[model samples]
Target: MSKGTRRLAAGLMVSAGLMGGVVVGTQPAAAYPSNCHYGISSLGTVSAWCAGGSGSVRAVAGCEWFGWWTTAYGNWVNVNQGASHVSCPWPYGVRWGGFNARD
Candidate 1:
């Protein structure tokens, strides 16, 4: 065969191999439900729990206002107002009604 023909065939084979590698060599995508984010200038909430409701883990629901943040309860937390919340795995130590926010 001509040199150009051989080179073209080789190039196609390499490309096919590369595509196959991209398809077959990749690991499955992981699911991240908890490690979540809202968006720029948006509101978000997440929860962290302890085994027996005896740990003091502050899981924050955050609100971003252009760049700043605050608690959901309109308390100047740090940046903007947040709509965050909390949850206890065993429902023993954590209390209800606390985090609030304003527009």
Candidate 2:
């Protein structure tokens, strides 16, 4: 191949490599923490709530308990509730949980 053509090809390859590296190294904000709650408030808005090892909502204040009401406070109706993950009901609950990690 011509010298000028080869140099242009090499430059293109280097630029692609740099862009690929940057794209692969970055993480989205939604993928922040595992077992974190995310959704709207009681009045219907968006917020994020994280959970600790103790399994209680973390760093959230003045929020109502999600799912079920009255004397049966602890009871919930998550489609996939467990020690690892949970999915809340409507815009009135905790909504989503578990790691945002991709496999």
Candidate 3:
């Protein structure tokens, strides 16, 4: 192959490899924690506990008025060795709550 053609092919391969690495290394900002237990109450309380892992957990409450229109987020709790809890306090509406794990 010509030198110019070879250089172009090499540049293409390098760009492809770099792009692949970037994609593979990307991760979600929030994820479910491993070995963690979670629950939600009918009254819009959410809780979570991690038996293991070094991270933080928080509660998320989905509130509904006209529809599912608002979200109530709880404080971040360090769950490396303990539990986290949060509740939705919107009195005029119904709500569903869950948990999220943070790095």
Q: TM-score of each candidate? A: 0.30, 0.31, 0.54
The residue ranges of model 2 lying beyond 4 angstroms of the native Cα positions read 30-103
In model 2, the Cα lDDT at residue 1 comes to 98
Q: Write the per-residue lDDT of candidate 1 for residues 1-103, one digit (tens) a residue.
A: 9999999999999999999999999986533223222222212324432222111223444444444544432222211223234433322232222332211
State how far residue 100 of model 1 sits from its true place (Å). Answer: 33
What are the lDDT scores of the predictions, listed in order? 0.39, 0.41, 0.71
Between the candidate structures 1 and 3, which one is better when assessed by lDDT?
3
Sort the predicted structures by lDDT, highest score first. 3, 2, 1
Instruction: For residue 23, give model 1's deviation from the true position in Å.
Output: 0.5
Ranking by TM-score: 3, 2, 1
Model 1 ranges with Cα > 4 A deviation: 31-103
Local accuracy of candidate 2 as per-residue lDDT tens digits, 4-95: 99999999999999999999989854432345555434543333444432223322212235544221112222212332223343433443
What is candidate 3's CA lDDT for residue 53?
A: 60
